[model samples]
Target: MPALRTIPSKAGADPLPSPPREVEPRPATGHLAKAVRRNLTAHGFLIGAVLCFAVFSWYPMIREFLLAFQKTESGRSTWVGFDNFRTVANDPAFWQAWGNTVLYTAFALVLGFAVPFVTALVINEFRHAQGYLRLLVYLPVMLPPVASVLLFKYLYDPGYGLLNELFDLVGLPAQQWLQDPDISLLAVVIASTWMNMGGATLIYLAALQSIPGELYEAAELDGAGLLRKIWHVTVPQTRLVLSLMLLMQVIATMQVFVEPFLLTGGAGPEGSTTTVVYLIYQYAFSFNNYGAAAALGLMLLVLLAGFSAAYVKLSRTEDE
Candidate 1:
């Protein structure tokens, strides 16, 4: 066997270059960059929507609020804080219109709320003729407001109205409908209920259908009669929907305008049918008093906000 050969060393010469420093490949563009781009693109629509709302909705609301505190002359405004509100408060017609509006809201709510719930319950009990009855009940809702108001106007005519004819047939006195200031609000309420109850009835009907059949069966087994079952099970089950409908009715009825405007020819005899919205319209367009109109609008906003807050609190309480 040959002896092991000695290996040579580069003692004087530069050592072989250290292995090239391990160069990590540069990472692709950072995740943060991509994430930022993705977020901007995804939220672009929301940003645009916010811009539009600010430009259109919020700006106008603020402008109206400011206008409410100012005095206007030939479309120019000067600050006069609280004066417009004072003027509105002092106007005799303001109180009158407010009273009429409150009365109309009350009457409309009572008829609108009760009648629809009753109709929904009755319709729900009938397995047959349900479709036909629903169609008939909802038919008025499909009528254009102008058309419905016009039809009711004719029906409420002083001399030749169908209501008068019916009264005569039933051996009752034929009283003036829309012509009488005392009963004109009631007449409008009746027509409004006829037109609006369809939508409410349908909503209530759907809520009623969603109630559990097991609850009804249990009630029956416990010797609950029909009314008892409804009072205990049906009413409780549908209470949320009922409360929501009640709030909706209050909001809508508070804004009543079109029917009374058309039927009574804008405020009816002795301004008996003048609602707050109607008065606002008259101030803004009819009289061109934008400052006063804006003040009234602010007042309405305050009222609606209070109502909305109450509704939210009530709903939260119910949930708790």
Candidate 2:
């Protein structure tokens, strides 16, 4: 196309300014570059976390799911559908292990769940040495778990154990702590409680400290005793924490392994202490049946997941 000439400005008027150039736009990359530069470290950390979970957590879970449906022999894996599940179900130890696990969880709920809260309550009442008491309570948690278990093993010895000696001093019978199947699981529960209660106690203490003292004063004004005040004021105020801790304790107790494994050789006097997780260990390591182990592990996982979902739904319903 031919260029057209512009008309000249009138005399005494400023020359017409040249038409402004329409410069081409540069790439819209400045903001994007700044954003990338600002978040580079965060992105690096996030990617690292995702990779760790993928390799260490998610991959094993996926492998377990696959292994649950397959049989591996001499480095060869073949799909066998639900045969592994059937095998796990048919094992005689299966029901016994489940029963023992349920029983352990019940005992733990009764003892382990309540003891920490009670300790917190007692400690909260103390006007002096509260810090020392907390330290003393939490000391067990700081100790190596294996060392704690071994210490309990010595205290549980049938002959000349400190527990028996204490019983003797109290004019009670020196009951066998770890020898009888009837009491062996209970002994393990006691040891587990002693070992694990510290963290729970501290959590409970913190919750208790947050409770308003005026509630207790009001309860006392209503002629409530200590028990009445606790039942009416403390329990209701700490219900949420109690529920959460209860759920956590149930899940943890169901997976009881290290205590029974170390204290009573995982089976504990005719399998009284054989929990689901210990059974899984037995299947995988002792019996060399990884498929069965995976099947059982999957079952436990599903059950726990269902329980957690149901509990959460119930909690939401109640809140609503």
Candidate 3:
């Protein structure tokens, strides 16, 4: 009475395969939520920086632009259109300030631009005490600018000054540093060069170090003198750095303020040291002509911006 089972024959087809198991797909919501959180955190940091820039930098520039066209009087601001610009243009000091600023920039290019590169060259040749020499050169920059200027003020005194004493020892006539209009700007330029050249020297030194030693060796093999090596190998190798520094120096010197302001009492003898920025200061603070001040500032901003654009374009073209 039991049920009988039969096995498949050897030549028969194989038995059917078992059904495959079903697997559940994972949900993507968790991954999406994590991505959202990450984005939010990144955006939160960016928002803070953007807000700060908007409030501090962008707002001030916008306000200055508006102020350039408005006259403020009796605690009230009124639309003045081009009146501010016209007023500034008509002032006699305008031309003189521009002239002096140009002169200052010229002097700076002659001394400040060259001295740093020369210092860097000298420092690079030294095999010992290089760090000490660099520290010594940069010591003035580390000191408070006001303190350094005051120290120079004492040194530049016509009487009982170290400089005058040195001149006396050399049998040279005592000379006025800040009092004489003819040389006051030159004196300021010298002080500025001394104060600022340390940074440029370091920059040049870094650039010089990056140049390949093999090029220098090849020059030496070719019987190149020191000056010849500099002209052929050094100058071309650091041309980009030199050009950039030149542009920066010109821009900075054009905006000369602190040196002449402190050393020469802002105008020096016969308005010889009066610069564009100083004129702006005179407009805003001395004369209380805010509109004119803003106008002049706007002019300076436009000029520098345009020059920067042109310079950058030229550089790119040359590179290409």
Candidate achieving the largest TM-score = 2
lDDT at position 124, candidate 2: 98
Q: Higher lDDT: candidate 1 or 2? A: 2
Per-model TM-score on C-alpha atoms? 0.84, 0.89, 0.88
The 10 consecutive residues of candidate 3 with the worst lDDT sum are: 7-16
Tens digit of lDDT per residue, candidate 1, span 20-88?
A: 788887557877677778898668988999999999999999999998998889777899999989988
Measured with C-alpha atoms, the lDDT of residue 126 in candidate 3 is 95
Model 2: residues with Cα > 4 Å off, grouped in runs: 1-27
What's the lDDT for all of these models? 0.90, 0.93, 0.94
Alpha-carbon runs more than 4 Å astray in model 1: 1-52
Candidate 1's TM-score reads 0.84
> Which 10 consecutive residues of model 2 have the lowest summed lDDT?
7-16
User: Where in model 3 is the C-alpha error above 4 Å?
Assistant: 1-45
Sort by TM-score, top down from the best: 2, 3, 1
Per-residue lDDT over 1-320 for candidate 3, one digit per residue giving the tens place of the 0 to 100 score: 99998887867968788899899876799888888797997889999999999999999889889999999999899999999999999999999999999999999999999999999999999989989989988888898889989988988999988889999999999989899999999999999999998899999999998999999999999999999999999999999999999999989999999999999999999999999999999999999999999999999999999989999999999999
Give the Cα RMSD of candidate 3: 4.8
